[model samples]
Target chain A: MLILLWLKNKLAFIPYFRFMQVLLSHSKLKELISSLAKQLVEKHGSLNEVALVGIQQGGVAIADELVVAIRKQDPEAKFEYGQLDITFYRDDIRKNILTPDRMNLPFAVEDKTVILIDDVLFTGRTIKAALDVLLDYGRPGKVELCVLVDRKEHRQFPIQADFVGQAFETDRKDKIKLVNDEKGNKQVVLITG
Target chain B: MQLSTRHLLGIKDLTQEDISLILSTAEQFKEVLQRPVKKVPSLRDVTIVNLFYENSTRTRFSFELAEKRLSADTINFAASTSSAAKGETLLDTVRNILSMKVDMVVMRHSASGAPHFLSQHVPAAIINAGDGINEHPTQALLDAFSIKESTGGLEGKKIAIIGDIMHSRVAQSNVYLLNKMGAKVTVCGPPTLIPKYAAEAWGVEVNYNLKETLEWCDVANVLRIQLERQNQPLFSSLREYRISYGINRQLLDSLQKEIVIMHPGPINRGVELDSDVADSKQAIILQQVENGVAVRMAVLYLLSGRN
Candidate 1:
């Protein structure tokens, strides 16, 4: 009765719910992650233990969402979370201010599918950094990249996102911002200079 | 020119032409942060190092986030755990990192002249994060930027940096920079912190009590009182510190609502300022934090030659 009652109320709350979403709708990102997970499993066979590594700060949330999405898509898929602190790996560490904490997953990554997630896809250095760190974590069946926004711009590295939400263009100066709300509404916008 | 391989050394190193270029660059950068697409193309191949010896969350993080938004490679090195802790000398570490060939270095050291030292030592451009209560030039610039952006400009403006003037690199830097930009500067702290002939060097007025100074100033930039700073007794207690010189709701009433308030924070909420006052409408502390990134971005881009 409580589930039915909640479902009825949720149906009523749909329009306003979608309108006020900030970053990305949990449902939508979940849907995207699910779609990607389905393709991965269908090609590579059933996932045993899958590890989602976020690129710290922004990427962590996306990885968490993807984990939930993967579990929902394939109930048999075991999930693990990890983060990379690439501060030390950075070339400019000596000249910057304070470093953010290294949020790392202590679990072993042997024989796991490590799908790295980040909020936005830029020049891929951050992804490159994450990849280098994840390589040290352990050998995995495969490493995949997923991002919420993949702005079609010039990238310094030879990497591409396996799963991309939307690709857009920006001037050399303007920025691409994706804001995710508490309710999971995400607005991706292109700013002008 | 590539934005990646430049170094930002000091504010004084920036010519008026360089200053204008950085501000315009920052203006463009700020536009990107507001856009739906929050990533910029500048500094694509560049790497930025956040080397902070001083414990600061605001300025340090602002630079970090700025580097992130600009699509530049960023590295953070706090003093708590690093070669600095390994008893490795600062120049030795800088030389080692320089050998690694990182693009730019943003440095904050507890020792005064550390930034200047880094400037001399490193082949990479060095932006002074904060040096030993000596000169937080960027923080000073951000405060000026916030005030200028809000209240027209700094020309003929009356700005007071109150509390713990002796130990405030912020006050010292702000005094020189704001005066350079044609703002009337006033240093007001308890008599001990506001020592003899201190204002004379900067050619600014000095004030003792909070009341007259609060009324006279257009901007009251409060300094965080390092309680550990008093080698001898300056104030009796935190309560006495608050009662004597703290900027609070009562102090806010003495000035017009438009008069901006500032603090280089990790603010001792009740000691140097009241809680609500720090977050109040007059308080541009957070704005100062935000402007810090944009200003430092400008500073870094200038010294970096990647411009």
Candidate 2:
């Protein structure tokens, strides 16, 4: 009976794992992250006073990767990195409540250039919520949005990403996610049912 | 995820999962309280009215502070000062408040099931502050939060609810919450002060001996002797009750193991608990008060998420 139950669980999970199409492979993702780091350096010249605040859970990995890439280039990049949970500020809370992620902004954002990072920029709602959370913390000198994948259409709010790894058109029903493979390699996949 | 029930009428209405969620959410809110800017914009567009029929100090302030920290607009209505003094009904008063575009109501009444009745009649979300001696849900949540903070978790921990178990909403709420969370509970007080069938009805141990109850439990939640709530004499005298059940320094020092002490406030210090015990390092009474705001913030935040 236990074996049958385990087999049923595996059968239920197989289709979800098998049908996903990889939009960005592990190597491509690495290159994209490195190039994004270079782009950030090119734009900011130096990250001494700039701070990278990742929208929690999804954006944390990308932010970590970008920090490592920048450190490899400059060895002394002193940009402050933090994670922000936008659960409290979401506009769709009345519809459904999601569990809050960890928030760890140790440094003050006052008068510093804050770059808000996320994995995918979809309906612009998460970024909007992140902005509200940021302003409540302190008044930053300037704020910029950074994302790896930007769905170029169907934005319910007027918001845009300042830095992007890739921009594409996706169906409103399609799900785009950045996930880790079993070997601990990062990859982007589009799951459709 | 949101809470299972819309109205926090009592701990009896909450599932084990719901209690855990509220505690975890409160953990996050506790971190928020330590921040430089301690206010969050979660309930910015929401307006809550605190309708307190019974006089309160801590619970009222804690709920109002929680609402403020969530950035919700608030209006406080005390029964002594409000139109309720003119014999306005609970439904009529609440309907009048709801007519002013209020989204939620935090209420406390001397009558049990008052919040439950208000919830059925109104479209607004209702949170029971304390409805007579029935249950105080938020107080239990805060108590559980405090216990978790001190003792790690609630599961399998022996907690003794000491003194005035019959008259205490705090004790009853703690019993329901602790039982649901897999904690062992014991009701300890004089025979008259303890409810009949507390052991059978709630599935908790009943012990009249304070020393034995203190030795068996990890945490001792001593309740206040509510002089105002008692219409007739339940105990012989205050001095006798003190000699029998009051937690003193010498009794605690004589215990084989160190036990955490707790109290729901406005303590009749000499009757149920001594000053030294209440102020000792082993006591988390003040931490319980501080956690009240955070737990309440989590409750309001989660409930406001529901449609």
Candidate 3:
């Protein structure tokens, strides 16, 4: 696993799995989450002006893990947490009917540094929709992106994640998903034909 | 999830899953209404036409506002102003509108099955706002949404729909929707105002006594006595109806348990529901109107996704 982590971006040409391969196991996922939390606290000093918003469905799980990690580091952390569902703001709404998930942003987003967290960054369309949704709420002081795993070089929109747990150069058709394992643990997996 | 039917012609046409989908989507739209900017761009590319052959205040405004909230381009057509008043047929009016690329039609007519008639002739989606005494699907959806919001879920809940049951498209639609959602419904009014077939056909309890119905139910959806629709007097007078069926404060206080109150707009003040009960904390009459936009938006959004 350590060797696989060291050979991060070099796995672009590796024969992709037919079934699935666990990219980030339990312990490795914990390490990446802690690192992401540390980076957030280091960048945004007191965590007072920052608001962590998770994209609904997958991103919410990663956001929960990050919140726990951040709280563990600083027990007095007073950052705001929110969950957003961007199904209504999507550009492909005319294609098919999509069911919306929960969206609860009790706190104000005006003039706050909003950090959007997602499980995997792929075509960047979800981020675009998230940005549209956030702007409707209020003007933010600053907007940044964070993802547990970044699938590089496949962005359809001009969006990038500021804090990334892992970056992989993979095929356009390849799928990277953050899912829960049997023991109720967060794991990132790569799926291919 | 998508609606099973292409047109929201009536609640009888919807499956349990379809009702659940619309209510859940309405819940999301309700949240959108609470935000500072209460609009979404889901239906920005769609064009809708509201065709009203009959006069309406709440339904028309609610649908127009719902369309605006979804960012859909809307053109309002009243039978009094347009070619409809010049003796133009419903089919021709709709066809002429569709020729200009209208994607959907929200219609209300004095004739029952008028929207259904247009659905067979037109290419666009049809949403029946109200059709004579047939059904008002959006009103029922909003009532269901309000009931769910107030009392939680609809399953196994007792709901009494009181007042002019025979002439109410709202009452018919409510019966269909609430029944599908597992709510035990009792239609209460004077026997003259309730259809004889309501019990056997709709599978709802018919009670002429308002007090007994109120005591048995968890929610009282008091409907207005539609004087405009009534050709002849169903009862002796408004004062007599108020004495027997009116839901005053004393009648509500007599019940052992508190019941959620709901009305589908334009209350008669002292006819079906009294002023004190209408203004009380138990009444969700205002919420019903507020939920109307959200529920209609959900319907339009779901139907526009269909081919």
Estimated TM-score for each candidate: 0.59, 0.89, 0.94
Model 3: TM-score, first chain: 0.89
Residue A36's lDDT within candidate 1 is 61
lDDT of 3 by residue, B15-90 (tens): 9999999999999998999998999999999999999989889999999999999999999999999997788888
lDDT of 1 by residue, B1-307 (tens): 1233244434444444444455555654454454444554446677877888778888888888877765678878877888788898888877776676688888888788887777766667777777776777777778878888778878899888899988777777788777667789888878878868787777989888787888888888888887655578776777877888987887677565557788888888888888888878778888777777777666654454332
lDDT, residue B280, model 1:
84
Candidates, DockQ: 0.02, 0.44, 0.64
Q: What is the Å distance of residue B211 in model 1 from its true position? A: 1.1
Model 3, stretches more than 4 Å misplaced? A1-18
* Residue A6 in candidate 3, Cα distance off native in Å: 28
Write candidate 2's Cα lDDT for B118-228 as tens digits. 899999989999999899999999999999999999999999999898888999999999999999999999898888989899999999999999999999998878878
- Ranked by DockQ, top first: 3, 2, 1
lDDT of 3: 0.91
**lDDT-best of 1 and 2:** 2
* Candidate 1 chain B, run of 10 with poorest lDDT: B1-10
Q: How far is candidate 2 from the true structure (C-alpha RMSD, Å)?
A: 5.9
